[model samples]
Target chain A: MSTVLLDGTEQLINGLMYGCFYALIGGGFTLLFGVLRRFNLAYGSTIMAGAYAGLIPVYLFNAPVLVLFVTTIVVSVLVGLLVEFCCFRFLRKGHELAPLMTTIGMLIVIDETIVYLTDAVGLKYPAPFGDESLALGPFLIRPDYLAILVVSVVSFSAIFYLLYRTRFGRAMRAVAERPDAAQILGVSVRHVNVLTFVLTSALAGIIGFFAAVSVGSARPEMAAWLTGKGLVVMVLGGLGSFPGAIVGGLALGVLEFEAVWFLGSSYRDILAFAILFLVLIVRPGGLLGTRTA
Target chain B: MEYYVAIGSIIGIHAMLGLSVYLVAISGQMSFGQQGFFALGAYLAGLSTALWGLHLLPALVLGVVVAAAVGLLVGFPALRVRGLYLAIATFGFGEIVRLAFLNVRYTRRIGDRVVGPNASEGFRHVRYIYDRGITPLEYLGIILLALVVVVILFYFLERSKLGAKLRAVEEDEVAASMIGINVTRVKVFGFTVAAGVAGLAGGLFIHYSSYIDHDMVALPLAIASVTYPIFGGLGSFVGPLLGAVALVGLTESLRTLHGAREFIYGALIILTMLFRPRGIVDEALVLRVKGWLPLRAARRPAPAP
Candidate 1:
């Protein structure tokens, strides 16, 4: 194979790797949009919160890298519940725009809190892969990325299982499909909302760990961009559809990576957003979204 | 004082941006792309002066027109989306515009010397009018004049039939359309005008500082624009103006706290949402204040609560 072909193949694999992570993150965003029917802007903060949660065990307890995953999940779930109670529950009866404004406020507060707690500076994530890679005939794939891909795929499958095979999944879907009807059927809407948020946020924790590790550092400022990427993935896939999020995320990941590779690196975000803007224009429902009307 | 004059001008410029958001607020849409329009206007004004030697007024007007044109294009499809989806779509447009500018390279002449605008460096020597020795006070006067005109326009718009139609759409889109008001037309028009005003503000901002850059119009700026109308009260012409003044003042006053400033600012927003979701100034409050002023129109009997 020529050098260009090899580079192209490498870029495709890199994009796919990123797509796996984006899918994991986008699932959490879609879950909130699905169950609550609002953009939980705090989702970004939760990702950051996951990173900072690891800060405690690593710094205070001098814990090994193994502690990071547990801390991330635990903290994300707590933050998820906190957001549910403080930002979401109160505004349920308010105007349509109320939740948006309030959530934005919540995002700022959470961001600031992280900033205050940590210096809000970048910290290196402890990668466990140790620079290992498996070389194929023409391409070398990093085990780190493959690990993340495996983890993402497994997590997504687990989510599907939880959503499809479990009793909790039925109750969660029941709430999403018909909240009042679900309530009449003896499912507590509040419990379902909180529980579903916890599940989704736990996924965010895993995404957070992998993202910071892959990118080499975690910074509080990454929240907005992460949120935007998640939104791009969520909308591009079709809102409220996990399967669609995975497909859209993979496509978006490749599109963004190739945009930087072919065009200048700065053009990556522009291309992603341009596609998102076009998607909103051409098919508001997204690639895999069912036509509403 | 030059310092006070500069601060006041910044407040005025921000007020114009706030009003841009306000226009869309009344039309019942949540748009977060005014910063993109502002950047567009700033670049246009900056480029016209640097490259083509256009005067201030024409450049500003041109910027406004172009921004409005882009707004129409972006809003044509975006107006079909509502609430959160619309906000995200506008945000996507905003990021696209900002990134496009960041990637665009500009070469220009500055007093017999050639300079290039880099990826993030933006354009300098923007205020050719200022280079001709327009004093800060004079520039502030120009901005104040423009603001007064915009405010007066908003005031009249509040009382106008079309304004009522826009408000009607905000209150309920289906009902407005059922009553024969063209909802799509109204929304697109409001978005276009709003973007034009933001572009006008962008022109003012770059010229005032003699610089233009892409970073100045990012996501945070868009969020700030949204905050203005919501914090001040969305019901009246004064809402965005008041919100802008108060928030800008708060921000400036908290400058002493340094890093804590953003935290405090965020806290204030959360507190405001908690305590005053209706905002600091609503219809009743405006009415009461007007009642105390003793103007003829203000002297009308209070309606029964």
Candidate 2:
């Protein structure tokens, strides 16, 4: 019984750490979706771009870890703007499928570019928090895991404060609730949309930085896995609900970790997807999602 | 050569994929998960033929049936969901299917010490119809026959009462409901039909390739299928076919150019959205050059009607 309790506690800690990545990815997805009203299929690719961006600076210049994080975030912001200007901006008011198709195309383009640059080989990166481990009773926790959790919490709080307390957040909410009305009321919907993309992409970059630390490797295919999982998390949380993303991410993380613990690592993803499918079938709007509109 | 025959069959497989997307999109619902069904069909067919010792035709049929069943199960909930939520649900379903294939112990059939009937046993020999020294022209003939059958079936269905009802529901669910059309039923049926078509394509693809794996069924392929129909115009039956030919042809031609092909696809999609939002088949648009020589040209004055 004591052994089981120890195992459970360890699993719980692991789940919390894993949930941090999901939360960051989900938050970025929800933010963009809220303001753009369009799903960006290339979102995962942006995260990969961020990871590579962070790595190149670290490897080439022997830069500080902080600089790597900042560089990645900035590059992701630029990429987001590039996607918006190149693929989305012109089709903002067009048919719904237009932008979706454009983004799908963008995903392929970005993925192929990454593959070309890296020769489809996975690149290893130095872990930001070093290889130090801390033990709590029988459970051993890595410093990187703790750092990831801290970063996720800080990022989520920052986003929440920005969304609720800032004037720009109010304008964004206004645009999301009613674009034409917001425009009539002197809000620049275009500016709001662009800013939202930049912010969301930057968040994805930060998440990428942490993900590289956790996995100790960066690859083109990293984005593909996250994109699929992130989409699931976004849907399971509710499409446009900010708080729902947090709840959904945490739930998914915990559940997936427990599954991995019991069912072996191979079956972990299977269990996660089963839960996703069940959630979609049972509660399409996700927990805490408003039914209005 | 045998290589030409192989290429032709692959094209046929892609054509089937494009048609599945076309059928779904025409009803105003977008699915980015057809590749999941395609993978399911291929894997099931391959396993049945190679491991279960089933005949190729029977295995193909069973594979398609299984795909349709899975599609119906997913479609029930999907029919009720709308917009981005529906898209996400389908996307999630696809991921679940992929992960299930990856993780399920029953799927792996090699190097297990367990004894008895339930023990993991690897696949062995499997045969396809095209293995009998069939020529490229014969394969093309078979493909054309299948294409004709699919076209006729879709044409009749799209012109039928059920198809009209589905279209009505797509246009306006509230209005469709008010007119006594069962919107839910139409949506479910539409989704099921789309799935069935995709299942058939998947089965055909497996038979054509005679080999299958998880990577074959992925999101990029799904996205490609979706893009084909839209890029071709999506206004008529021929649109997706045309789009598939252009896209596949372009990709193949640029296969040796490193990453340029994908870049072109991305650029094409962006350009299409910006300039020809309606697609290349715009009836009102045409390019013409007037006679360059002004010397011997007769100038006509405007006449009052």
Candidate 3:
């Protein structure tokens, strides 16, 4: 009974840590959908790009955590801009499926590029974070987990401040709410779009970096799950809901961890989406979304 | 010659998949789950023939039936969600199905040998057709015949009430319902039939390749399936066929370029979307091309009645 109790507590803490990270990733996806009203099919590929970029400094120059974070953010922003120009900008808005197709094309391109760069192999992180764990009584939290929690909290809080507390944020919200009206009112909708893409891509980059840490390596080929989970999170939280994204992301992480706890880990991926599918049927608008026309 | 036959057969299978995607699009829905149906068909057919010594024809039909049924099941709830939600839900469905198949344990026997699905090791020795010694050319002929049959069937379907109903729903679902067209039914029917077509393709694919696995239907394949219809222009059935042929041809030709195939696909897609947002073979473009044909020129009304 005591062992089970200890295991449950440990799972809870670890799940919370991961939940926060998932929230960040999900938040980024929801942010894009909120601002752009289009799904970034290349979201996962950009996350992979960020993860790969994060590793370059560590492997070649033995850069510190700060360098990795900065590099990932910058790289992700660039990729986001590229996607916006190459896939999204030229697309005719409100077209049935043009944007989606273009994004998928971008995803294929990025996936192939990463595979070519890495020779279809996984790249190990210089900072493995496997050897260190913070112990408190009967629970042991890995350093990476702790870092992920802190980063998630800090970034989300900053995002909250940005989205809710700033003039630029208000401008962004106005554009998202009514792009034409905002444009009429002299809000440079384009500026907000660019800013939103950069900010969300940076957040996705952070989440991607943590994802690589959790996986113990930067795997270009195996990075599709980040996008899948992000999609699951975005939908669960509500397509254009930020707070919902955070909650959905955390919920997905905890749910997935609990699934691993109850069922075997081998089938956890299957159960994760299966559960989300049921949720989608039950709550089509998600926990926080308004029904889209 | 064998290599050419194999390539032709693969192209035919992809064309079928592309058509399946095209069907769903005609009914105002998008599905990235055709790959899931494809996987289901392949595995089910493989199991039927390998385990019970069923004939390939029956196995293919049965597999298609199962795929269509699953499509209806997935499409029913999925229909409630719109656009992005539907796409994601179907995607989730595909991943779940793939993972479920991957974790299963199933087996069948050959002459003094047993083979089956082996967790991550994949399903092996699906050699029923190959073992029967049907040549690749014969296989190619068989698939092409099926494609022709499907084309003819749909050609009639387009003139039928069901196709008109589907087109109505695609134009406007509320208006379609208002006009007593049964929008949900049409949408579900489109998805179901599309899945059946995808399943038939999957059955053909496994018999051609003579192997099966969970990863056989994956993200790239699913996305490629979706892209074909869009790339070919989803205005009509021929668009997907044209798109599949051109895209698959491009993919094959680019195979020799190390690390450049996907980049080229990406670049082409981007350029196509920019220049030909309607795809390379939209109705307008087709009419234009047809006007230049020798037969159309020859039948030019002779400047009199």
List ranges where model 3 is wrong by over 4 Å.
A128-130, B283-305
TM-scores for every predicted model: 0.93, 0.90, 0.95
lDDT of 3 by residue, A74-125 (tens): 9988998899889877776567677787888899899899999889899886
TM-score of 2: 0.90
Name model 2 segments beyond 4 Å from true. Answer: A92-94, B1-4, B47-58, B103-125, B135-137, B278-305
Q: Write the per-residue lDDT of candidate 3 for residues B137-247, one digit (tens) a residue.
A: 888999999899888878887779999898888889889899888788888888999999999998888888878777778787888898888999966788889888989
Docking quality class, candidate 3? medium
How do all the candidates rank in terms of TM-score, highest first? 3, 1, 2
- lDDT tens per residue, model 2, B125-185: 2345444665457756766676677778778886799878867776788998999998777
lDDT of 1 by residue, A1-293 (tens): 88777788888998999888888778889988888877788898888888778767887777888788899989989988888877777653655656667777778878887777668678877877777778877778887789888998789889899999999999988888888899999999889888988898898788788878887778877788788889999989888887889998899988877777788687788788888988888888888989441
DockQ of 2: 0.58
Candidate 1: regions farther than 4 A off: A1-6, A116-120, A291-293, B111-116, B283-305
Clashing pairs in 1: none
Give the local distance difference test score of model 1.
Answer: 0.84
